[model samples]
Target: MLITGRTLRSLPVLAVAALLSVQLLAPYATAQETGRTVSVGTGEPGYAVNLFGPGEVTVNAGATVTFENPWFEPHTVTFYGDTEPLAPSDPTAPVPTNPGEVVEYDGTSFLNSGFLFEDPFQVTFPDEGEFPFVCIIHPGMAGTITVVAADEDVPSQAELDAEAEAIFAQALDGLKTTAGALAAQPISEQANADGTSTWSTAVVGGLFGPSDVQQFFPASIDVGVGDTVVWESTVPTPHTVTFPAGPPPFPEDMMDPLAEETFLAASGPNDAFGGSGFVHSGVIGLDWPAGQSYEVTFTAPGTYQYICLLHADQAMVGVVNVSADDDDAEAQATPTAPATPAPGPAPTGNAGLDGSGGGNMVGMLAVGALVLLTGIAAVAARRRTAR
Candidate 1:
């Protein structure tokens, strides 16, 4: 009877233990359902390159952003715009990882900073803005996060138009002149001439002319906003004008070194207007951003200089002073083959060199005999023609 009474009392205790287990497990199971999954991988494909499975994830407040570096490369999973890195160390214990997520190399770079462990990104936005970040080692590896205010409405059409117009003006009005053309212009830049206007331009030898390339012409040039410059090459060898620097980004660096952003003008073997020098068909052609032009045109309001890569010293430089204007332009083919001198129409000494050739032999012999008496007359006529 005593054993039966003891068993009856233990039943209530057992019931209490069962109730405690339910309470502990319920919250954890709920957490997983609400949590979001972000990824950090090599951004490449194949087993060698693991990608972010979800790529992107969004969750309500108090939810977690789980990051997994599935590949061998070290990765970081940090909150954008946050002061400190995520994936903090656990003094008491190492952070636990889910299946398929592994932490590899601990390089001094940010990846090893322990910024992407099981942790909270800790921030979310209600308004629209962008957050861009990158993996320093691999170029072109970057991601952005944008948040939009739930209540904010999109901008009207007028606002968008104004923004585009502003950008258009920014790109034009900054090109310099062409290769030899800039050389001939006033180098001193003053409305008046100064000693500074003079400089020995050795690069002009490539242009074909024996005349020394003087300050009278320059290899390249740059200009301020709303200006214009031109180029005309003297060399029969086809030359091109190209600007290496790309289009303007901000207002400060708008004028790149010359007007071309890429292949502006693709001239035929007989034409001009490419980067630095002329390139044949086997070579890649010029390709610039903002826009390309062989003829003179304002390239979005900036200073630009182009030169011949082939003949550095001759056919060398071009300047385009692009400015804010509606004027149009195109790449014009350079005229005339300087190397191939054209044939003339006049008759020559060929007849005299001939052996018994061309027209009446007997009459010619008689005329030759009569020439003894007419030698004096012939001499007089020759002297008169010489005078």
Candidate 2:
């Protein structure tokens, strides 16, 4: 039990080293104990239609799994059997004619994350079995969690991360392709035998594929005040045409029946700010024959920005520039379509946490360890001087 000054100084060094090691291994240790962290939804360009990252995961029994949603929209992680069967439709084509149905989840007896939006939901597995889940809001999105015995081996964090990256890249590419296709379609204007011209554009979503990439054709358009513009839905999924509300108060609910009345009440020319009250088409689901169309006449002359409520974060937005000039006569004589807007670059991996917090924690820990080591060195030097 006699300890030398040199040994005492070395203790601090070892302590600092151990602390640094624990800091570095914290995430992995947590992952092993609480299963793995699967991103519920990749926000922004991809939206929440795509379920868990890696699509599938394996964890040990008695471990907890956390599902984190980085997107602003709400999504659910519900066990597959708990949900109703699909109405018999092609998975590779647009969504089925049926609208999103109500599926209940009580968090137990059924394992579900009711509605997650920018929050992490955790569930524990006590038995060894494969649990398949899907987002009730977007039934097309699915994933599975395989729970094995306590001693079973699972994919490491690096493997899961790599798989997630590849999946996200593919999702982003698909979104860009859908957006580009919709943007390239030319706006059609039918001249009525009377005089007025009806300008129309298709609001498409997964019409040609199984993706939930909703977008407004010709993202931007120019029209004279008083001209009516119609948005026809070609995809099976529902969408909303919502306009921004100016200083005056307006309801934010796009699905409200009163929303259409409010929009019509504000119809006419725009004020100085280019906004004239709020306008929303409510939820426009697909219809047979001609499809569902929502027409709005811009009374005031100003630029109006609108978005599809479901896919706004995915950048499904459109603009309407209303000019003061009356061009009904010329539009009736000869209709000319505007040039298609160029598609923007695909969204890079801007979905996940940018490592700022992790970097800050590491930096702080390193600084603390360095400070402790410096103190140990100073104590050792003092002990040598005393000797």
Candidate 3:
């Protein structure tokens, strides 16, 4: 082949164009090679409770299905029959009974990906079959995967992504509506003459079932650095008030020294801690006659964000804006209706509480009445002390 200088110069241009084309097509090729990556939960603001997007998916036999958890909470992808699914009323009840049950996938063998948080779990299907899975922690959360013959066509990555987007959008709208309804309820408050404030946690709504979802009565609040803020759980379900810990002025020290050390030891490294100090109120359960309350006096001035570790991903988050000016704190503090007895009966058979019998409405009512009376008496005593 007789090569001319002009032709040689054109060769470089052609090669460059080919390289650009390959670069652009790389993503699509990789998507196909990787099979399908299904997002297990939504990361959208205020709507993180979704179980899965594209609740059902189709993939070629022998293709790998990657389940990704993008939200803050932990989830699992366990095939039906792999293990007993916990009742929706008592999701956490299974953990004790089914601890460390890891199943290895062997085509016919049961498969279960324990709880996953901010990570992805992958399982390859070597045969054609329909597999249904659920998050044992949330039995109502279920999905299905259809594995067709190798030659059958499956939904592409683009299609799955679009479907996920739509699902998340709809979930976000539902969350906003639920949150707004809860927000409309008058927050119960009892302001002290000493300039402290308290906010109660309420069962706002449920994700999988009744009372599964909860949030801070006043999701946001303002206070002075020296002022104390207290959070009391008003429901039987357990919850934690957790602030990401890291950087200077850790808020853990603001709590009891013993509690702070205990939390640090259990929480391990604060790799996820951005700048705020880590502070956690260990599992507040119904058995705590004191109403499972936690109080922290802000030592530094800034906007601190916190969450109920159990329901954080479900948008159960709150914020506290601390200022140096007492006047500013008092002005910004949310006003609330006077404290009153919470209407609903407390959950039954909670391990901490009496645990006499399941669904003890009368027992629950008695407990509620006791709590209401205690709150009233405490307020009166505080007023007397102040006088």
Candidate 4:
């Protein structure tokens, strides 16, 4: 069904009793053992941090918190109430992360993957409450842990099913929103051999990016250094523009973990200068220089990659490679145009080559949460139905 909901109007007393039994014996049935592990990935639903792996684990009393390090970046599992301060803590602090705090489990509460990290916190929950935690590496990645009371009275499975349906509806809505934002973005803005991509790659039939500037309109483009490359959004959903190098002000080459991700407003067309631009609203209109067409142009050579920031799953990325020689060669080969202007000439639709190399790296986020989300819905439904 497009939507799911249990038809049960009432949960039987026996079912409720059964659920209570399961909840009660959970703490004692199992002897002291390994801790429960969780993860919180960036850009997840309702996450404050924009990293990855905000995984969740349910626990009874005496459950431990084991945070794993799957990503190369360093991260820590922090509590909401604790404040361990120190100098030069993360400047991106404020819901992004808590820096310089005392390590909860001898820094094992944090995982840096030093040669090989096997640190796990065996701290038992021993009570019922919600504990939210996140990855210190990516900052915003966050998730929650719920400890259920041994004697707590919970509703039947059928009652929980109804509540699951409601929350699932909200999740579907979030997907729609994310898709819309994707549709509004320029899947890519490639840097051309001559510093401008004359066509939209999709308009020309290339999948990842355009091929060769030979078939482009004007056969090339022109612009000052500070000009912008405007990409038109034809499809309205399920696409993402990603940059493997992260947003610019790009470092000479930020390879090691020790280097901070660099960002800068650098140079572009006509010998003018410009910084990197973000997908403020996803859509690109004719909002460049007064005389410059939304088309790309350049006076130099460089390589650039861009992706639909929202639809990373759809694998939308574009690469732009510009060279001064490209313009020189085109200038020597092309015929001069008459100074008269009428309707715009037909665009060749040849979105020359592209470089959106950061393939849908973030696409798996939505799929990874499906199972957990379903369980959460079942649990929450029990609450709503009982009300």
Model 2: what TM-score? Answer: 0.63
CA lDDT of every candidate? 0.28, 0.52, 0.50, 0.30
Query: Which pairs of residues collide in model 3?
Result: 245-277, 245-278
Q: What TM-score does model 4 achieve against the real structure?
A: 0.34
Q: What are the TM-scores, per candidate, against the unseen true structure?
A: 0.20, 0.63, 0.53, 0.34
Q: Name the candidate, 1 or 4, with the larger lDDT value.
A: 4
Poorly placed runs, candidate 1 (over 4 Å): 1-31, 42-47, 79-130, 146-387
Report the lDDT tens digits of candidate 2 across residue range 1-387: 011222234434433443343334222112555568777656333223354677799888777777776544445666635544333122212221122333222323444555554345666777887777776656467888788898878887678867876776577566655655665566766666755455776454543223466456655567776667777776666566666445433443222223334322322232223464556565565642223567876677876766554444344456677778756323422425333553233232211111222233223433433443444355445545756
Which numbered prediction scores highest in lDDT against the true structure? 2
Residues 200-248, candidate 1: write the lDDT tens digits. Answer: 2222222111111211133233333322333333432223343433321
Candidate that beats the other on TM-score, 2 or 3, i.e. the better one: 2
On TM-score, the candidate that comes out on top is: 2
Q: Where is model 2 poorest over a 10-residue stretch in terms of lDDT?
A: 348-357
TM-score winner, 1 or 3: 3
RMSD of each: 34.6, 19.1, 19.4, 19.8
Q: Could you give candidate 4's per-residue lDDT for residues 231-320 as a string of tens digits?
A: 333321112222333233322212111222211111222222222332222122122112212233333455444333222112223344
